[model samples]
Target: MATTTGTAAPELTGLPLLGSLLDLKNDSLGTFLRARRDHGDVVRISAGPPGLRATVYGVFSAEGAQQVLAGESANFRKDNAFYQEVRESFGNGLLTSQDEDYRRQRRLVQPLFTRRRVDGYAAAIATEVTTLAEEWRQADAGTVDVLQDMARLALRAVARILFGTDVDAAVEIVEKNFPDVGAYVLRRGYSPVNVPRDWPTPGNRRAAAVHRALYEVCDRIIAERRSSGAAPGDGQDLLSLLVEAESAEDGSFDATELREQVLVFLLAGHETTATSLGFALHLLALHPEERKRAHEEVDRVLAGRTPGAGDLDALPYVTRVLKEAMRLFPAAPVIGRRAVAATVVGGVAIPAGADVIVAPWVTHRHPDYWEDAERFDPDRFTPEAEAARPRYAWFPFGGGPRACIGQHFSMLESVIALAMLLQRYDLEAVDTVVPVASAITLQAAGPARCRLTPRNP
Candidate 1:
């Protein structure tokens, strides 16, 4: 059923039955890098037993990525084993929806993330970041877990800017269960001995419970919005817009679909940003010189005020730092696609039904596009430097039409949070810790412990 092109692709073999699945699960980034280094751009990696077929073509070059993500995207679909993990945890939301379902959801959901709409959220984001800075300011000197703190901040910001009245309940549920939910999804995705989600395994039960709680929370929010008759512009929240936009028939999302969309926004919007922000601050804490430069830029730009979206352009250095952080450790490191038809990518044949992987983790560090690939250098994002590299070379937010819809929202939120935090607090790394690239997102295995000290303007 699955076959490569005329010239067979280099393949990475693993232990019998389990195959490369263990290698991938153990060290995904390392496994992908090793495959690319041993083979060329397109390498076939197989897992599972001899009788069963489970494979993914690891493509780690710009040209190869463009072919699958842009050039011949129609030949691929999100309905694949890779996204099956996401669907099991998140349901039939935009992230996992396929075909006409994806089309309709995208059409209805796209408007809420438009640049103008995202810009309107800047003030609230700035306020939330300022509030967080003030809270940390109270603890003049203390060590805090950067990832946990940032995750909380990102969740609060998303709740305020997107959901109106139900923000508190949503935040509580996510705070309590997101770690378990995210961990299960990521682990199950790469587990060779895949188990049905309904199976009463401990992990499965926990994930199921989290999903039920989240769904119930979403249902409550929807019900309140319906009873309150909140119109679009009445609350200017994402839920209100969906409620107002719904039609009797054709191109409208029903209650169930609406709940899925909200969870999508909450899960996707917050998780990726939180992970990236945690890494960004961690990187800055590690590099004092970069931290100083970021502080200098913030000082000069705002002089001493909270930052909003308008300040983003002026704080170019802060933006560059965030960009560079994502380049180094992208939140969604791998973009997984499945071949719906046999296709050729970078001159390598890809069999239909094969999982196609394009990782920013690999491409962002490709020697051809970067001078010092492993180094933490924000200057690489400078206008002139970035212009010199290939477009798909540093796609932290990904590429093509299916690229992350919350790119603008994420950027705005990160920039404001970074600026505000930098202006008011000095976060110094208290420990050397690298994040573990996991099934959901790249996350700190332990905690990103940092000493926080209030700074004077």
Candidate 2:
């Protein structure tokens, strides 16, 4: 971090403000690593909001990521300069809330995301994946958009598991509104002067309109479930639990609280998984051997028929492949923190109010911690190989107290989905995709075109 303490400085690219922002906007990871290599691990740049400066670190060491995540309160706050941009879209939900609000909501949702609880949903999750694969199989052979397919499938899975409903209408609502939330929050850091929430700008108004529509849909779902008395015959789903969740202080969650939780889980839980699964498939297709080996692992573990909860562990190869894919292309990609007080990380002074982003994409691929860095190697995730790697070398789902609560759920879904897909079909990328880095999750700059075909193994 460049400070006025007369400390020696390292070289940096771009000019002062524009360089960091340009590098970040263009290629997030590249800019950071390139900066780190030129300046140092702890480099300070004047980007982001006015009062908020950015301190970038290439924290590939697992211990570091763990510490940051575990020590979230001491070192960070989620509702920082950039996060405010997305608040209208996300509300005071778990993912975007700060301090005590985060803790309270996390408690309510914690029990539901337990490994055992998530395990119960494994079959259902895999069933959704299999169902989607079968749908793709039924489609005429040609360029299939894996990203779009996975997004819809993931949305439906969450809708069923969390909301206890088919995503039929939810899809239209999300398709129409999801972007509004992201665009409202993400594009150029938010400010009262420019991207004002109250402004009648077409974009802002559209985002606001979507916000109202989403809550309206959630209200209807809650009303329907309440009116029906949530009869026991239908399969168990997330909506049932949410509707039934017993609050710690209060007896139960109120309508307003439930609305935010549903939206949070619906978006946070599913969108990320979709991007990740799609990225996994994309990477697997590029490396045929990895794909074949992953397919073999699924075959050996599950053979024929559907994969169940217990089968997830038996499919470690599938897990490794998934982890390796996430390592290479983390869906969320970056985790940002705002320093609560003046502190030093790697001997750099982090001014209070500064925005510190620990970019997983840069750290995951850092040569300081990874060999080859760019190659697809599931072997790296083998227990022994992982033991040799730094703790933060991988943060696809992030780490620490504020880390993704739905990590277990997402992983199970991914492993089972990948196993089921590879066992029954083969896929390969079609045209080159221009990777786009936006949304709550990372997606192809353009839709990922792929040729999906039935596989025999």
Candidate 3:
């Protein structure tokens, strides 16, 4: 065990009463980056007025991230306000569940995400990609918003895979209502003070209404699945698998639990993967040399065939491109946790019950780990290079027991989609800078427009 220096970690200077709240709200990603740059890895960030003030210990180094997320994961818990906000809106699914509930959920859900099982969904993913490609091919305008299109594509693909026959209903509900829910979570998650959720304020009422609609759609589909008596062995969709998942110790998820898990899958599955795919294409479009390498790898490995699970390993360069994109723009830019007890991390003493965050957004760009950190270089992820870096240096899907369960599925979906898209279109970025905001997830706040020219044209 390492001893702390017995000194306070550096703190970012802020307003007299509000601390870092305004800066954080206005530009969270930039604020975090500035924190790391100005105050090293362990920086104390206080927010809100003194009465309701929240102070977070920002751990912004790969080693610090490893300590918080993986090494001493038990010491850092998801009991913070941000997670509570997410849980209230999204339900106590795997993402926000704790202790035994998390363990049980993990055991039941783990087998469903096994490499072989996740790989089996490649055809469904390819179908969505093909649909998008055809739409782009027929469009009179050469440009499209990659961020928006990829979100729609990923939602459709995951919805189809999860709900199967009921995909149309699930997609319609999510497409119409999820943005408001996400916005609500982000706004409340960060604000130090909030109006009571039951007060029927405009935001509260809208959020409540959307939550009910989301739950109702999911409950109806789950009910239909139950009525259909779909066993996991015979059924191909995720909902069926969840319906059938059972154990002697934990039995199975009940109706509400099932809805919660479905909601988690719908939110995490599409959003993170969509972020990866959108940014991967955007990065490639901006860097011609990297794009050329990706194109060559896709063409050579795929050879005029639609990308599938088997092609994942063959397209090494394409994988690296995706990895590099993730490094630059991790889907979950900042992850929040609360220290269960006093702990020493990166030679800084974090007091018990302190709100802590390990920022992949900063760690992925840590000066010690990444040379030319701002550059979009796929070669940074080559096998040798990856081995030389810390494990948490590129944690886009997070780390530890609480890590995102859909990681394999996200990668598989991204690789197949990127390969297929690269094979069909030559891309050029219409917007040079894709302004992003750290929302519930890392979101492209502005348009990520890209011009596509059919390769054969």
Top of the candidates by lDDT: 3
lDDT per model vs. reference: 0.82, 0.72, 0.90
RMSD of 2: 3.3
Tens digits of per-residue lDDT for model 3, 300-354: 8778988889988888899899999999999999999999888888788999899
Each candidate's number of clashing pairs is 2, 16, 0
Deviation from native of the Cα of residue 228 in model 2, angstroms: 2.8
Q: Which stretches of candidate 3 lie over 4 Å from their true place?
A: 1-5
Worst 10 residues of 3 by lDDT: 1-10
**Model 1 Cα lDDT, one tens digit per residue, 1-457:** 3234656688986887777877876788888888887887899998767767478898899887877777777877786755788786777887889778887788777777788888989888877787777777555357777788889999998988667756788899978877787777767766556778788988777778888998898888888888885545787777888876644444577888888788888888898899888889999999999999999999998989878778879989999999998998888888888888987777788877788899988898888888878899999999999899878888888778778889989999999898888888887898777657656667667788889877874
lDDT of candidate 3? 0.90
Question: Which candidate ranks first by TM-score, i.e. highest?
Answer: 3
Candidate 1 worst ten-residue window by lDDT: 243-252
Q: Indicate the residue-level lDDT of 63 in model 2.
A: 49
TM-score rank order: 3, 1, 2
The order by descending lDDT is 3, 1, 2
Better of 1 and 3 by TM-score: 3
